[model samples]
Target chain A: MKKLRMSKATGINFLTYALVIIAFVVLQVMGNQGMLSSTLKGQLVPICAYVVMALSLNLTVGILGELSLGHAGFMSVGAFAGAVANVALSVSVPDTGLRLALSMIIAAIFAAIAGVLIGIPVLRLNGDYLAIVTLAFGEIIKSIINNTYIGMDVDGLHASFVQNTLKLEAGGRMILNGPMGIPGIQKTSTFVAGFVLVMVALVIIFNLVGSRSGRAIMALRDNRIAAESVGINVTKYKMMAFVTSAALAGAAGALFAQGQNTIVASKFDFNTSILILVFVVLGGLGRMWGSIIAAAALTVLPEMLREFADYRMLVYAIVLILVMLITNNPAIKNFFESTMGRIKSGKKAKGGAEA
Target chain B: MLAFLNHVINGISLGSVYAIIALGYTMVYGIAKMLNFAHGDVIMVGAYICFFAVASYGLHPILGVLLAMLVCTILGMVIERLAYKPLRQAPSLAVLITAIGMSYFLQNSAQLMWGTNQKMFPAIFGKTPFSFGGITISVTTVVTIIACVVIMLALTWFTGNTKMGKAMRACSEDKAAAQLMGINVNTTISITFAIGSALAAVAGVLLCSAYPNLVPTTGSMPGIKAFTAAVFGGIGSIPGALLGGVLLGVIEIMAKAYISTQLSDAIVFAVLIIVLLVKPTGLLGKKIREKV
Candidate 1:
């Protein structure tokens, strides 16, 4: 029975990943065939980045059962870290692809370090306090960055919170100029790169989820006291999930920076964090494929509904309310289950049940 | 000394607005187990209503204020019934998400209705500064402080003396037990939302008058600040909220005065973290053992 259960879990996961690959390949083929619009083409790279962001957020919010309102802070950290590294390394690395890849690694490393530092104090708190602290941390990071200045030169990178503190060499590249932010970055991120990163994110997340630590993390989420009684190290597991989530978010941020020239700290504020949270929640928490679909759809939906620009957010709000109502209402839930159950039974009875 | 006194007075007035808004957060949190994330947007909604009443309809400013409060009270009740009522038995996460959705809905709808352009909020009170002991105070500030004190006193009395208030108190303590004792828990909860929202309306008017920038997004920052006050004072405590709100206001004003204006927000959050680290339950919150 245990063996069968494990196989079923793997089968479900395989199907989900297969769906992502098929969708990605089909989109790629469509782009190559010149069937896709310029607008749609522009969105492809961002869709991948957002999907990765949603996936990382799901690890913390869904799997870990912690509402982190600072996922975007990690993203901001990654974006700036990667961008700074790129500027600092521009003189020697003629290969934009190599620079982008290297920056992404640096971004993920920095984000992971940040996650560990933040998670240590933050994971010790829970519920609303945790939510608020995460929010404050995001705001604090943004505020600090808003006051920061960084310049790169042959002498190396110079950073300062106060003015006139950094003496730079001739031909020094200014990566961050306080509130003005980093601009004129080389756009090296391609749809292919985003797709590869998504695959990487999916592998790390799925592998982690299948592992023992993942079970322990979810166990603690399910029942903290019960999990503690069963000898689970609550803080350690929570920190693991948070740090991994931060690392993945950093990678996504790096991809995002490569896709765009300008990256501002304000772009990754509480609102951005909440928007990502919406994707995670709307997709159904802890569901990997659901988040992929949700992240892609919601990002596209705003752009597609641009014709009815005034009513777009209004419609989005209505949809948000409706989804929550439908999902939470017992009567609505019962109806879906009954109808779905009937459809399944009508199909190849036992096989349908297994599927 | 006079400059310091001026800052203190200014802080107190600002704090009064936060205190009133914090009261709503505390009251709702005390009764309902979920944070009403939409409470902040409710302030925005109230401000818009008042702005339209005075600017568009040319109503008396006092009437406009009253109208905003009444409308917000009803809006709060309707929101409670429609958005929150169905999810009472649902997990806390669902409820929290729903509240966030409701807040978003309110904010965007307001944006759609009222253009994103900043509408001018009229000065209801005369723009005259009263000077005493080398310190100057705006009439609006004095009125705001008076209104806050009056409302706080009235609320304290109502909760202490009135039958419905007692019922609310009971409901907050134990909803199931309150219902078992023949108290209408739903009504109590609805009333709590109404009062909270009404307070938000009062705060909305005061906030806009002080800053006079009528934007759809105005309520969010103050709402968040007030929530921090509610947490600082103790989430479920009334007087705790008052004290927390006032203290937060003073700190924020002082920080802006003496520290980097851009970093004052960070300073406020830092203070909250420090407070939480020292006392997780907040200043006035009673400790409750979590059951497995």
Candidate 2:
């Protein structure tokens, strides 16, 4: 009986992986055939990035029970580092595939380093204080990026590195260019690339959750004192969770920067952080699959509602309130549980009688 | 030297505004043990109320301010009744999320109603500068300082001397015990929200008058800054909120003047991380030991 149950679980896992791979191939073929619109293709990269961000943040907030408002700050670091790598490598290596791979690896490494740097100091603080501190860090990083001058010499014009890098022709222009935004990024965000990244991220997170370290993190979430008493280093584990989350968020940011033709410092502001947080919370905390679904759904929903731009945020606000209300209501939870219980009991009875 | 002094004065004026707003945060957190993220949006609402009264109804700015305060107080009570009351027994995380939701709801609703365009606030005090000892000061700055001081004094008096204030103190110290002692927990909580919201409203009006550009998203930055101030002072301590706000404002301004203005936020957060590492309970906060 136990063997049968194990086989069934393995079968389900195999089916899930097969379906995901098939979807990836189908999407890639569609992209190659020019079936998907340019606008839809343009959005795919950020959506994938958001999925990674939301999933990773779930590790800290949902599983580890920590509120981090500075996820985007780490992302900013990753984006700049990634952009820099891509720029430098594209100049040196003539091969596009090799350059892309190298840039991603560089982005991931720098983002992970940034994560550790931030996590070491702030992970000890718990609850809302943690949230506020992270938020401040995010804002500070954005402001610095906005003010700092970047430039390179092209022809006779001494183009600011930032402007030239963003494809702005420098004549001492205030281009993103002074808050106008960075344009002309290489559109390397293919559906297959995004799908593979998501699959890898999902697998890593899943394995981590199943591993001893993940259990230890969850133990801390369940009961910090009990976990500590059992010789678990709560602070270290929390820091680990935060750093891992930050690295994932950074990776997502790098993907976002490269995918979009235009990137702006203002786009990664406090509201952006809050929006990502909403994805994590709305998806059901501590549940990885829920976050993935929520990320995809929420990303698509706003774009679908673009016609009602003014009402979009208002609707978002309402959905947030409604989601909280429904989730927290005991009656709704009980109703769903009872229905599932009835179905399970009926199946058990039928199987028993047949046996 | 004079320029430095002038900057200091400007910092104090801004700091006082932050202090007033921070008090609302600290007070609500002290009693409810919930971070009222909507408190900042309540300030935005208050500013709009004043704007409508001044622009639409043509009321005097002072009267508009008073009306806004009253409306904000009532709105606070309603929010507590509708959004927070149900989650009183829920986990801290639930309430925090709910507050965030409420904040987004409030801001977006305001946007939907008022449109996203920046609205101009009528200047209550004339934009005349007063100079003394080679330092120049705006009339609005002086008014802002006086207004903050008066509000602080009034809050102190209300919380110290009034019956409702005593009940609030009782509730914060020990909710169950306060209930046992015949203090109505719900009423006290509602009143706390009301008073806190009123203070936020006053700060909102002041901010609008000084800055004169209002948008739906404007409350977010100020809200965040005030939240930091609250933590810096001590989350549950009122006077600590004031001290933290003043200190934060000064540090931010000085950082902008001396260090790169871009580094101001980074420096402020660095201070927060350092302070939290050393003193988690905050500057004026008494260390709390949870009864396991």
Candidate 3:
């Protein structure tokens, strides 16, 4: 029975991922046939990026039981770092595919480095304090990005705090114009690239949660003292979860940057972090597929409601609260669960009768 | 040196405002055991109320302040009852997310009502600079410092002396045990929100007055900063909040003054990271031993 239950859990997880893949395939086919609207087509890449972010954040918030409001910071770092690298390489390597793969790798490396740098200090704290530090870290990254000056040239990369401090070569170009940020970034991010990233994020998140290290992280989350007493390396596991989450967020950031024409530091503020958190929570904690669905739906929902421009965010806020209510309120949860169960059973009965 | 002294005074006044807001954070965390992420938005609501009352209704500044506090007190209680009260037993993350949602809800609604443009919130304290011993101080700054000190003293007394305050402390110590002892945990929680909201109002007014720019997003940075302050001093501790707020304010001002203005916020956050790394419990936060 225990073995059966374990398999059942895995089955449900697999089923959710399968549903996501089916949806993506349908969307891709529809797009190829010119059935999807332009607005939705534009949103597809973003949906993928946000899904990666939400899934990555789940590693920390859901499984590891820590709140990180700075996931967007890691994303911004990845975006800028990846964009700069690609911009410099644009002169050397004109191949979009090569740049795409290269930038993603470089971006992930930079973001993971930042994650380790930040996670080491931050993971030492607990609960709300950790959340605040992560938030501050996100804001700090934004400020730094806003103040940063990066200019590229045949001589080499020129970086400085002062905007005019870097004297570029006669033919060299300014990659990041400080507060103006990276303008005209090469748009190489496609649905296919985004899909691979989503898959990468999903694989890491799912396998980690299923692994022994993942269980140790979750154990530490539930009761730190007990886990510590049980000889779990609490710090190591926590850092592992945090750095992994940051790295994925960075990868998503790189993809998102490549998809955009202009990227600014202000784009990755505290609100962005909160927006991703909303995705994780609405999706259901520790539910990877739920996060992917929530992230994709929420990303598209706002654009879908573009007709109600003023009321869009208001409606979004209301829906967020309502989702929270249904998920948390026992009365609502039970009612919804019963309704879902009935529909499923009703379908099963129909199939049985037909057979 | 005199300029530095003036900045120090300014920093203290700024810190005092933060301390008031941080007190709200600490109190709510102490009693409710959850971070009221909307605490900052409540401050924004209060500032807007005061702004409308004084700017539109032509009410006296003191009366305007009182009205704002009254409305915020009610708003705090209402929010606690409607949203947080139901999730008493839910996980901390849910409550935190709901608070975030509540914050955005308030911000978006305010933007819809007031628009996203900055409003020149009238400084309740008259425009006058007090100069003595080669130093200049704004009336608003002096007023803010005095007001914050008074509020802090009053809060200390209320929590340390009053019967309801004692009940709140007891509830914070152990909710189930306090209930078993016949304390009305619900009322205590409501009172905690009410008091915290009222403090947020004071902090909001002074912050707007000092900074002199009011927008829907105004309360967010300060709110986060105050939360940082609450943590810096030690979560759930009043003196910790005050001390943390002051130190954070001073650090921010000094960093901005001596270092790059662009990196001041980052520096402040870095300080918080360092402080937390050095002492995870914060300056005054007690280390609670977890039981399995």
Candidate 4:
């Protein structure tokens, strides 16, 4: 029975992977055939980026059961760090794809460093306190980025905070101009890259969730004291999940930034964090496939609602609330489950009766 | 020296507003165990109501404030019933998301109702600065400080003495136990929301009076800062909220005054992080022991 259950879980994972591949192929074919609109085509990379973000956040919020409100802080760190790496590498790395790949790696490393630093003190707290500290950290990161000035010259890189003291040479170029962020970034992110990143994220998360450490993390999440009594290292497991999630988010941020001509610190503000949270929550927390669908649907939803103009956000908010209420309602959940169960059983009963 | 004193006064007044806002957060979190993200949006709505009442309709500032509070009280109860009540048994994260949705709903509604334009909040008090001993203070500052002190004292007394307040305390301690003890947890939560929203109205009025800019997004930053203050002080502690708000305000002002202005917010949050690292439950938060 246990082996059967394991096979079932793997089967579902395979289904998820298949769904992604099929979707990618269909979209690619459609794009090649000129069947996709420009707005939708532009949204594809961002949708992937958001999908990775949702999945990463689910690692922390769903799997680890720790609420982090500063996921965007890590994203911003990755974006700026990745953008800078990409720009700096332009001199040495002549290949665009290679440069983008290296930049994402650098971005992930920086974001992981940030995650470890933040998660160290932050993970010591529990519940809302943890949430608030993450929020404070997010704000702090944004503020620091807002005041930061980075420029690269022949003399190497110059960075300053709260002042424009970058004495660049005649050929020096500004990488990050305080609040203005990185401008004229090479649009190196492709839909294919995004798709591959999503697959990579899924593989990492699935393997982790299937591993002993993942079970330990989930154990700690479900019952901290019990897990501790069972000799699980709470801080270590929590940090592992958090830092991994942050690294993945960093990669997504890098992809998102490289896909755009310009990236600003403000783009990864609290609202963006909340928006990603909405996707994760709406997707049903620990369900990875649910996250992908929710992220893709919601990312496209705003563009689809462009006709509503001013009321777009208002409608989205209402839909969010309604979805939460409906999904969480036990009565509605029971009703839906019963109907689905009956539909399956009825089909089986019909086959038996025919036989 | 004179400039420093002025900054302190400005800090105190600003801190007073944060204290008022933080009180609402602390109370709701205490009772409901959910961060009411819409609390900040309620502050915005209150500010808009008061703005229109006083500026557009020429009502007395006091009357306008009262009207705003009344309206916000109803709005708070409505939001709690519609958006939050159904999610009572849901996960805290789900409730939090619902609260975020409510916040977005309120902000967008405000933008749609009142065009997305910043309106200068009228100075309720005349343009007069009170100066003494080489120190200048605006009347709004004095009024705000007085109002904060009064509200704090009243809240402390009410929570310590009133029957309803006792019920709220019971609910906060353990909702199941409180319900078993025949305390109406739902009504208490609703009342907490009402009082919190009413305080939000007063906070909105004072916040705008000091800064005097009214926009749909005006309350959001301050709301976040006040939420930070609530956590800084201790999530559910009233005195902690007051202390946290004042210290945050002072630190913010001092950071901006002495350090780089742009980095002040970072400094303030850094201080919060340090404080939390030292006392994970905040300055005055009681540590709850876990049992398996």
Query: Residue B116 of model 3: what lDDT?
Result: 91
Question: Highest lDDT among the candidates is held by which one?
Answer: 4
Identify the runs in model 3 with alpha carbons over 4 angstroms from their true place.
A335-355
| C-alpha lDDT values of all predictions | 0.89, 0.80, 0.90, 0.93
DockQ of 2: 0.51
The global Cα lDDT (0 to 1) of model 2 is 0.80
The deviation in Å at residue A113 for candidate 1 is 1.9
> TM-scores for all candidates?
0.96, 0.89, 0.96, 0.98
lDDT of 4 by residue, A156-196 (tens): 88999888898999999999999999999989999999999
Comparison by TM-score, 1 against 2, better one: 1
All DockQ scores: 0.67, 0.51, 0.66, 0.84
Look at candidate 4 and tell me the lDDT of residue B209. 92
Candidate 2 scores an iRMS of 2.5
- Mind giving the per-residue lDDT tens digits that candidate 1 earns over A232-262? 9999999999999999999899899878879
Arranged by DockQ, best first: 4, 1, 3, 2
Output the worst ten-in-a-row residue range by lDDT, candidate 2 chain A.
Answer: A155-164
Q: For candidate 2 chain B, which ten residues in a row score worst on lDDT?
A: B88-97
lDDT of 4 by residue, B63-146 (tens): 999999999999999999988888888889889999999999999999999988889999997669999998989999999999
- Candidate 1, CAPRI quality class derived from DockQ: medium
lDDT of 2 at B12: 89
Model 4 regions lying over 4 Å from their true place? A338-355
Model 3 lDDT, residue A41, Cα: 92
Distance (Å) between predicted and true CA of A288, model 2?
0.7
- Give residue B161's lDDT in candidate 3 (0 to 100): 100
